[model samples]
Target: MEQQATAPRPRSIAPVDVEQAEAALIEHYPRLVRLGYLVLPPALGRNRRVLTAHALVQRALPRNRVGGAELTVPAPRGTDGVPSEPGYTYVRQRVLRAALDAGRPRGRWQPPRPGQLPPLLPRVWGLRLFPRSGGADELALDQALSSLSGPGRAAYVLRGLELSDDRDVRRVLSAAGVEDPGAALAEADGVRTPAGSRDTPLLESVEFDPCSLQARPTDLMRRRQHTRAALTAAAAAVVCATLLGLPGDGWGRDGAAAPPYAQNAAAEAALDPAKLTQATSSAWKSADRPGFATWPARGDRTGDRELLRRALAAWARPGRAVRVTATPGTPVGPASGPPQLLFAGEVDAAAVVLLHDGVRVVRYAEAKSGEAGAAALDFARTDAADADTSTAIVVGRTDGNVRYLTAPWVTGTAVRDLLAPAAAGQPLHRDAEGVTDATPSPAPSGGCRAWPALRLGSRLVTDLGELVPARLTVGAPGSPRDVAGAQALAGWAHSACHLQSVRSQGVRSVNAWQFATQPLPGGAGSAAWLCTRAETWRGAGSRVQAQFQVPGSRPGAPGAVVARAEDSAACGARDPHVLAGVLWKSKAGAWYALAAGSDDVASITATGGVRGSARGALLAVPARAGAHAELSALTTAGKKLTTLR
Candidate 1:
């Protein structure tokens, strides 16, 4: 009996068959792919990594009914509610093993595995696919992961994605062929998760999910050029052979044209400068439509055919040295036909040409000295241009100064500091060509010190570092009026600095509405709640910001941004109603939850961490510092609303 007690029989682990493994892989495809994505090296780039992660997971199924080899499957702990089946465990290990192998460097003599190379099964052409970009925390986490070793990344992914304990991670890593699981675990300990993400691991964020992706075209212009070149080369050979057989001295007349054998009349017509459309001086007043089409060419060089040809050629086929940029949603394609000439002249040291293609305003600039390879082309979408919005266009920008080409209807132009409402507007002189003298532009990176805007006669416009300056208006959403009166200007001064958030967003107009004026709890003077909504030219991606400004703050000081939202109808023409709350500290050092809504709100309520209710649109409740609360409101129309974020 003593001899029989020498050793207890080791538990026999069941094998995972092909059918079982395939079923598990199919059921948990997204989870497995995410795990593989996190473990794969970031140097492969987002697009390739997404493809490779999927490839690894798809190849994880067992080869035959009888399992090829035993896998270390930990007992179910109910951490993620996924059953700890042998099949799932086997496929998970295979995916982990492949991901780690993909990160390893290829040896000169060793044959490369399928996982080590770019995946061929799922391939995309003429497009780049990647996960949507995350915030700074996600970027930091991705960089930290990139610095870890293959095994270390595996350890971290197991702990984060698989919700595994230290023992399970070590076992999984060892099973995945990690030479030193303990060292890998120790290495992973050095990489901490992003701050404020303890409850939700960064591994589960959309940035790391390969299944959900954002797609962008890859070098479309270059692809088109390549295709055109290939077709031209084939056509040129045929033309050359035919000319050599039939004609005498075929290259004599068509010397330069011999190489460019593909001659399309429409393409040539688009590049011709003489074909440019020009409107009459007073066409806008009598025309059926009021837009760029009725805008007469005004610059001094409008009749210069050579300069116009250069601009058209550059727009059609921008060289490698040309710097091209387009606003968010603007098209940068070659001209479809002759575009309307808005302006053409030398402003500063560059020859500038502005063209309108019905939908976008295109600006092309070249060095006046005819510098061989230096040029710039910019495009801004302007689908519908009216008298107010078409008041000004940015003609030139150099150093930290910008010049504007005022509309013919603009009787006078003056520069006003948006942050200084009390200061009188300074007169800005314009030349005979309607180009205004250069003014100090807003320092985009220099913080919110000052915002210089153009006060054109009675209308106000501000440059957002875009081709067209955004029109500034006051009053309610649907029927906004021109920024006028001392009260409107002062209100704008408090919230002008917040405009930086909407820069380069193709904003057509920015309306400031003082939705509510709430008195302080401890008589700390009245505070104003403003809703600034920026409407873009593309009719989408509108930005709304709710700001709270306490009375007697520093002059030109930006208000505290309580809440912000993008592409939301709230605080806009359609909805025109918004609710937001903030934890404010009174002058007496007492903390209180202050909330305000539009006039249309019937009642407002605060819940969680802090609780209060008010029948009107404003609420003030005593609360501790840093209290968290959820805000909901009922409008007069009985519509329920949550606080904007």
Candidate 2:
């Protein structure tokens, strides 16, 4: 993992100084412009809002406040040092908001009108100086710009000419033109010349077009002529197509359809099956390669010589076999039986199938995971010749991401263990497009679920299994402490017990011997129980369980060593079976839960139990050691329900 760098300290500089602000801005202006341009379209280009935003922010400098002492806004910082627009993010956000607001419809605000600007016309160029030059088009553009209204011209210059946003364009128009140009200009980026001026055509600011004359001018005069012709042709074509109803360029002169353009012949062939098969086969057999054929079964060595010759010619090169064998799986398409294929070694998850035709083929198998490994991808097993006919191939998910494994044939084990989980109750089918392994909409019957129980001690236990006295109780009768209440035995069969989550009937707390069947080791059987000093407590309250003894010595009782169960109490409630560890919540809203394993649970057990139990009885304390217990107190108001000790 990459380590994060420590943040730098704020630069000590006077924020109010406009000079410093400008200098800072100048340093970061390129980046700001690039970011702003990236966010907003260039067709709307640079205008007064951006310029004003730049200036206002620049003047405010160091600190983004009107007066430095009044509101000392901290300067924004970059990697190396302080930024010119210290709070550039804030300023940029504001500018972006304003720019967006300008685009929306409101009572007062309106889109600006579009107009052209004079094209660049150098004095050096004449009409005949360069015969094909676009001088006339340049002149026309200049004339168009000259004729546009002042507001229209300003809008075009700021937005279209400079390639800035509409907000900035509006600002420029306001600054350069009338106080409020208002509706004089609408949608002001490109020049929209009025229709039907037979004698004079306006040019200069043209609409965005990749094939526009501006980009294609070879000579000045030619460019001018071409642009004029294009416009005239477009206008005439529109009228002709709409009113005259002309037949467009429906077909080529020869009336023969031309082949569509393709990037490469091989790619084009791949798109067409007929061409692809022919090309592949011809290319494969034409090379100066040994000949090979499918091995035919020999009876009494009749075709044995022929088969050997075929195999040698097709596979053997110099001395070694070129192709290994035919593919082992059933042929996907129409075939006599399973397709025979020459096997190459496994590459990652894909099984390489080399054929005598020297064609490269790939077959994938869904890989089984969790057998053993550090990384998830390492759980794949590669087999050279998996020719089992009973096992079907288990393909990976779409995009072939998951590891795949293939059984030689269709078998129950292959389907149950490998395919079933990976299939995730998905539909399976083999078609020309390979395999369709889609997740079943409604999951298939017999979906996978958590196993019955985990092996704690020796017995097989279920969630509903009874909790007996042996599982909870510690020592024999009349021992020094008697190991009563709730407590875990240090060493015994009781230590190997675990209780899967079970639904309780009602509020119950007892310190008596109860045989409880629990999860077994290796997650196999359902047999587990504990002796005395072990208690199962539950409730979202403090005062977990009270002790008839003292304040800290062995409180109410010990609890079950839960593995992955969630329980909490505001009082001193600890898990009975602290094997998997215990979790407790304090009245102060502090949480304490042990980490996984025996060591952590041992730590929690050392702390002992609480002196009392909470009101909300979400727990059922089932302890070993014959001792009668009863709920002492119960809360009456709100959702708080605690059991009195």
Please report, in order, the local distance difference test score of every candidate based on alpha carbons.
0.80, 0.26
Candidate 2, residues 433-488, lDDT tens digits: the string is 12222211111112212112111122111121111111122332223222212232
Scored by lDDT, model 1 comes in at 0.80
Number of clashes recorded per candidate: 0, 121
* Tens digits of per-residue lDDT for model 1, 307-340: 7877877777765435678889998887788898
User: What TM-score, over all chains together, does every model reach?
Assistant: 0.60, 0.16
**Model 2: residues >4 Å from true position, as ranges?**
1-351, 354-426, 430-578, 584-605, 608-645
Which residue pairs clash within candidate 1? none
Residue 122 of model 1 has an lDDT of: 85
Q: RMSD, model 2, all Cα superposed?
A: 31.3
